[model samples]
Target: MSVEIALTPQNPTHAGLSGRLVCFPHAGGAAERFHDWISGFAPVLDVRAVTLPGRGRLMDQSPVESWPDLIESIVTRLQPLADRPFAIFGHSFGARLAYEVTRALADDEQAPNLLIVAGPAPQMAQRDRKISGLPRPAFLAEIEAINGTPPEVLANTDLMDRMLPALRADFALLETYEADRASKHSPLPCPILAVGSDNDPQVPFHSILGWRHRTRSRFECRLFAGDHFFPFTNPDFADTLFDYVDDALNEHTKDLHRAG
Candidate 1:
């Protein structure tokens, strides 16, 4: 279950943009994670990075539960932007949400043209066993073990205290998320582009292949250099996304031309 995250798009340009690319952040991540990086992908794709409550721009706000409510709220806020062709991109924890949201909109006008699931594959995706409910020390350790959380953030007590709620909320969202019967058996019609890093423990090369089962249409997998957070560490990671987006759009255009 993709939790109910109350992230309204902050970028006004999304309303009039041609096609939307809704990017969901990893666990404990803020919308800014992909927002600033996708400046180059603008115009062609209106990339809207989801800003959940209690982190990033919404740090002052209380975090909502990562359950049905979060997913419902995300759908409600993102519905209007589905006027044109769109893609759903999620990294690590965000990947599940993207898939779930796509399933939620299976019959609607908001159905995504493609799903770019980055980082962990569904079988071994980023969901810890109830770290959200763990004690402060244990929770922090788990986050650190994931290797995605920076050392500076862990070192800074003030920052950790402030961001702890959002982190825990996101963890809980993934933790309690059980694959429903429909999502388990029913594969999405849209194509899926699964991406991961070869060296990343969270996303083993073979594990990424499991995404093939989740899609009824096309499935493509690409591995990059670096760890799970390659997007942040390697600038080339952004290029990969752009390339995939361009390829998908081109294929879609060909399909449309043939149809006409």
Candidate 2:
């Protein structure tokens, strides 16, 4: 698949950016999830949001069910753009995918400068209750419990109907991800930043801190005030996010200069 189809550029016309920020959305979320985030980093970075199969413009296509296939497709499509200094940012389920993608690109000449994951930790042991296989009603209830879905979407039955298939598929992917299998690999060389909420029921504070184990380089975890979807819900999220990303990008540029 072409990278054009796999990514939706948020600031295509912006020029002279030194780095790129590739964003991956939460489960069942489309590229639009990062639409509001474009303005923050557009001046310094080329921002592109991932468009997974079975959602948004690719709604007609079959959702990728295999983890390895999904990762391979993303990595393959991203290779062309990976030539530049870039950062990978993902939320919730997307965070897990970002980690795997970073691992796959670890040896590339222009590997990601940083990896930013939000809303979930590297540990999957906490999710003991598998809701992906539950019937429709039960599945929706569990999704609601996560508090990631907006109230407007939950209230609209027709929209909910259209969204269920992708939701179910994504949840199944999350449920099947084996943490033990992932941990066997060497830790990433790039720095990692984990963002999470203090009151998030689905992912606790300790869980957010657990990401420190996944990186050989620097690891920092930032805690905000909100529920699981604090990335979108918290008022201070945008400023805080941009500040961290700016520092990382600056450091990456300095490293490239030293290497040259």
Candidate 3:
């Protein structure tokens, strides 16, 4: 089944930038959420956030239940964009999905310039440990505890009623994900920049550092002072991200010249 993916560029003109930064949203997020971020990364990096089905413009569409199905759908839609120098930035559940998509691209001999994973560890953890399957009240409590769910959304019962199902569905997808250990044998040939929040309970510093084991390329981890959704709270998070990207780009260019 073809999942109707809504791909919208935040800065289309900036798509011609030196490199592309494909931004994948966190769970229960929409591409439009990052519209302002594109401008923050302009001139050097173009940002395009993926709008998955069952959310945003594709809200009416049914969300895919399995990881393989979701990854396949995303790769199909994003393959064309692979022609240019690109990197990926995914948060929370999106981070793992981004890694899977990168692996898919690498298998097809289309590796990106860099991989940025935020708010999640590199490898998949046990599905039985998922807390998203709790009852509605329990789940809402969990969301509240995490502090990622906006106050407006939580206060508005009507909006919460509408969004809760999709949020649960997304949680189910993340909870049930099973990692393919075989793919780790040949990790993508690209640098990995793991970003973790200082207080993100879901992603620990140790787990983020584990990403080093999966890459032959340079691996670096940065800790930001915030919760699970650091970027949302800290206005300067985007600037920090771009700084790392700028450094990576310079090193890559230098390496190319040296090789030449």
Candidate 4:
């Protein structure tokens, strides 16, 4: 499957101002999901929401099945715009994907300044039940139980038809993923911000704490007031994320000035 994502805001050239933030979407999510939040990043930051194939305009294309291939595809396509300082953010499955992409960029001199992950955390706990192969009714029930999918989409047959394939492919990607054993290896160089919810039905507390072990630089966590979907559902997500980036970038500026 030849899959390439044309990130929104295309070139992302920063004009030597602030860094750009590249956002990856959750399972069955498209890049357009972050459209409303781009303005929040404003002049100080450039934001690019990656649109994976197999949804929206690319509905006819086959979704990439292998995680490595998918990561490489994203990294290859993103290399052009990575000229200046930048960061990467993702939610749930996208979070892990973002991390892997960061790893792929490891050999490069100019890596992401920070990483922000929401919804799912890295985990040691194993899932007792698998949601991937469940019957149609059961599958929808599981997705709904976790509050990851909207009820309106479930109610619409046409929408469900378009959504299920991509959802299943994303689930399979997660199933095949081999989580990084932070203790066994060196942590990533950039700081990480792990965002979660007190009541996220899908991702547990261990998931949040796992991020601490994965970062060699700095690590921060923010817990919001909703469930698994809080990253996108909460009205204040843009403000919260923006403030964190602002603070991080500001400190980065100071560090650069000090070194100079």
Which candidate should be chosen as best, given lDDT against the real structure?
2
Worst 10 residues of 4 by lDDT: 119-128
Which pairs of residues have clashing backbones in candidate 4? none
Instruction: Give the per-residue lDDT of model 2 (tens digit) for 114-146.
Output: 999985555553367788879989988888887
Q: What is the lDDT of candidate 4?
A: 0.75
TM-score of each: 0.87, 0.92, 0.88, 0.89
lDDT of 4 by residue, 1-260 (tens): 45677687643444556567899888788877787767666667778888777776667777776977897888888788676667789987788788778877765645688899884554442345678778888988887776766666678888787878878787777766654442454578889898888887577766777788767898988888877778777888778888787778777878887999
Of 2 and 4, the candidate ranking higher by TM-score: 2
lDDT of each: 0.75, 0.80, 0.76, 0.75
Q: CA shift at 87, candidate 1, in angstroms? A: 1.0
Per-residue lDDT over 192-256 for candidate 1, one digit per residue giving the tens place of the 0 to 100 score = 99888867886777777888988899999987888877766777988778777766766776777
Provide the lowest-lDDT 10-residue window in model 3: 119-128
The parts of candidate 3 lying over 4 Å away from their true place are 10-12, 130-133, 179-185, 250-260
The candidate that achieves the highest TM-score relative to the unseen native structure: 2
Per-residue alpha-carbon lDDT of candidate 3 for residues 1-260, written as tens digits (9 for 90 to 100): 67777777545567456667788887777887787777666777777889888778877777767778788888998898876667888888788778889988888888778999885554644455566778889999877876656676789897787677668877787767655463356766888998887887767788778777667888888888888788767777888888877777666667777999
Worst lDDT 10-window in candidate 2:
1-10
Quickly count the clashes in candidate 4. 0
How much RMSD separates candidate 3 from the native structure?
2.5
